[model samples]
Target: MFSGAQISLYPMTDDFVGVILGALGALDPYRDKLRIETDDISTLLVGPPEVLFPAMRDLFVAAAASGKHCVLSAAISRGCPGEPDDPICRSDAVGGPVGPLSLRKDAAIAAVREADVTGQPVAVQFSLYVMGTGDHMDEIYGCIDFLKQSGVFDRSKHFCSRLRGDAGAVFSTLNEAFCRFGPGAGHVTLDVTVSANSPTAI
Candidate 1:
């Protein structure tokens, strides 16, 4: 059972390099808890959901705080059979007995409600993929139901859903979607893009 995200940040400014470099400092608190590696394309963060979402939120907030439009794109995944299981990725959020879908949705909503509030506001669009399952659509539909009531949900779009709200709630909702919809130990992935301070937003 492994979990992680490959994330890239793009700041819309002449000083993109400065914004990106300064924003990375936000991950300092999570350094010990996650295995982080940055390359030209993106940064990989391998860790539990508890630490993962917050670390991302902080980093995004830091970049957005620069008053520059910013976008964060991420490919988040868990229980990937191809990847070697790392102890650092261990978390209660994965590999557990999955109960009723109704119950899981309830629990996920509760978790999102309790997320720490960040002042930054963001909009995200994402699609969840529950791989290697015959009843994957059932899981995806269930996740959709959860999102409609997630408070952060903005609307549905082609091939994905849109969410808008405080960074805390938006990220928490994403975390829940990743953890609760699929088989606890099965391969699941999320294609996500988040934006803040976008000049073209309307």
Candidate 2:
């Protein structure tokens, strides 16, 4: 039932420090909604999808808006092993109500759309690992099937699929996967590594 994300931002520009700092600032407003911690390598955010996805969208949009070649890499996980099981990690943690999927999708889409307006399309690649289940492979394949039919997947990659399209659609697809594979009776952990950048940059 735990959900969290570890993210690292790399701005491919001379002003990398400034760009990264600005991107981090985008999460400031949501401090109350997330448990955020930052060190030299990356920032960790623990919270529900309602706040987490929007925060991610805003942070990426803010960073991409700099028009510098940048890459945002994230590890989003739920029910991880050997981790403290605290309220922040729990899906039922006391916070604002979770928003509808459509609303979350809209937020991500808007951010990506804003970036796309600058004439650059954002590209994202991610691998989802569903663990702790007896039929893990079956669940994984089921999820993959769902993604392929979901209309947001790139279809060119497998096992580790490459997602390419409007940012919002990509994020929405990701969010759905995360939710579906989260902690359950037979399922224990869902780990995802996501890397995003501008199409021309990478």
Candidate 3:
């Protein structure tokens, strides 16, 4: 599907050029996996969640590592609107691509398990929707349980059970949830919205 993120980075400092450059540079290594476009306002990254979320995690980590107050605003979406017949948006039942259903869930889980967010005040908020399933809420809760035990979740920040926490952990949790429920037997689609920022300068 057309999973991607439109991102804007703001650094709270006078000489912000280097911080911006460094943050962008962190994404350079993932160039092969993502389609990145930057302008005066924001950077658009189009790719699968497996690659996109981690890349975002690295980008935000790089920005936060600069020891400046940084805020990353992003809009994450999936599916190709107005192109319902497109293979990316259509399900396998209609002879569409099914790679997303079989995405490596273990890899995403491992990524989140390995991330360290100690002492980082990064905050992230995201909502995940698993569509076209009779047991959608069950699947959604299953994913939520996974995120809760991951240790990066800020339980107090939750509103309606949405997740918020360290950028890396949040991205990793998102990746896991997306892959696990994205293209499964009962799931035909998945939608996610995410916003991440560091409220306190490190």
Candidate 4:
């Protein structure tokens, strides 16, 4: 299996880079066959599927808790190691009546297993498209009523979400939320997972 990760460093602090490098070193033994290549605000991690997955999670959690604004992106290719599928984990958008997308239970457990074992925060991937339900004018917003009524909202720049929570809760809620759209309305396919995460520029 092959896995890759990308992270975005926030707050743009001088101390941030050194801290993450140190933490990742501490996690070396726990991380399965991990490697690093870094730039100014991002890092790249590539490694085995199982080990890379969790290592990425642990690294980001450590970096974030260390008092830095950090977000991550990652992908894991299971079995084939060379070929991987696109599975989105979390998505935020404005088109449909719905406000945001979250996970169900099935996807959550699998992603968490990778996070728990490797000690890295999870990575969520999402792509928006119609799901074959709802009104045509509804367009992107499948649940137009729900979007206006639901109090769920965030202030992030990307209409997508990357979260870390209880192994089960995070993935399950994301999956469930996106699929909630119906009857001709499109939905985003979420493939959230954990890997040996590094910053994109680093």
Candidate 5:
């Protein structure tokens, strides 16, 4: 029942260093709850999905609040056979008896609807991978159906689906997709890229 994310932030501005450094403060509240390590490439956050997504949301929102175009790319995963399990990474969000796909979708949608609003608008595109399962495609398709019904759903892209809305809902939607689609205790990962205040957005 381990979970975590490797995330990187890219700010388009002359003061990228300043923006990045300042935005890091947003993770202060989550410091005690997560094992976070930053290196030259990305920051690795090891924690429950409940804390992981919000931590990422706050960090990205803080950076975007600078009024600069910002992109946050993340590789989120759970139940990886290669990674040793840590008690800090345990969470109720995932790992349990599997339920019907339709029921999971409904619950996921409800969770998104109840998500807190952050006011900062963002767009996200991501692909979900439900590994170590024979019915992986079925799970992915089920997740796609859930996304389309999600209020933030924008469109379906070539290799991924897009979501646009307030940061809260967008991240909540991502959390649900990561938690609900695949086998509760199986290996699942998300490849996500989020953007805010993009100058070239149309």
Candidate 6:
């Protein structure tokens, strides 16, 4: 059995591609499977677990160098085709004025309001599907609760199971949330998507 991970990063603008792709090139040596594709501002990648995580770390650092924000996702597999999975987390939740610590429910809602052209009572919806040995529901909630305290959201617009806020805050928050559910250095695979419309699932 083997498990791998994938990363799809949405740049703030199209011009950021050069920086993202360049980072991936520098990070390729860390993974056996590495590929980069773009659609508008999104960058996609697929590779083994070990290489994937480190590569993502590098990509995050690369992204931080030029952009104001970034979102990342990781997964692990117990069976299938890949390496072992690791559930241990080492990323900081709150690092700066905009990091995890800075993310609050009210602040989250405000960011959406600022970004939305409609400016109508804005709301964001999403569903999380996770697979692993232990039940990570509590850990998931922990992330959401943390978001609420950060003053970045307005109490989760629709469903408040996971988290709700600006697209960027939600994505980055989810990136940290999902990391909690990864397998313990085993083999795992993860996919996270963010869109204007979403189904109600938790």
TM-score of structure candidate 5: 0.99
**What local lDDT score does residue 174 receive in model 5, on the 0 to 100 scale?**
98
Count clashing pairs, candidate 2: 0
Model 1 TM-score is 0.98
The best candidate in terms of lDDT? 5
lDDT of 3 by residue, 48-131 (tens): 666677787788778888887777777665653532222323322222333432233344466678865634445555556756
Per-prediction TM-score:
0.98, 0.75, 0.67, 0.41, 0.99, 0.38
Worst 10 residues of 6 by lDDT: 116-125
Per-residue lDDT tens digits for candidate 4, residues 153-196, read 21122544334434233333333333454321233332343322
In candidate 3, where is summed lDDT lowest over 10 consecutive residues? Answer: 86-95
Q: Residue 64: error of model 5 in Å?
A: 0.3
Taking the tens digit of each residue's C-alpha lDDT, what string does model 2 give over 61-135? 788778777777888766666566666554532223435444534443443333322232456666667666565
Every candidate's lDDT: 0.94, 0.63, 0.61, 0.40, 0.95, 0.41
Q: Note the clash tally of each candidate.
A: 0, 0, 0, 54, 0, 36
Off by over 4 Å in 4: 11-14, 30-32, 73-202
lDDT of 5 by residue, 3-53 (tens): 999999999999999999999999999999999998999999999999999
User: Considering only N, C-alpha and C atoms within 3 Å, which residue pairs clash in candidate 1?
Assistant: none
Which regions of candidate 3 fall more than 4 Å away from where they truly are? 81-111, 114-121, 131-136, 156-168, 182-202
lDDT of candidate model 1 versus the reference: 0.94
| lDDT, residue 32, candidate 3 | 77
Question: Which one wins by TM-score: 1 or 3?
Answer: 1
User: Which portions of model 5 show Cα errors greater than 4 Å?
Assistant: none
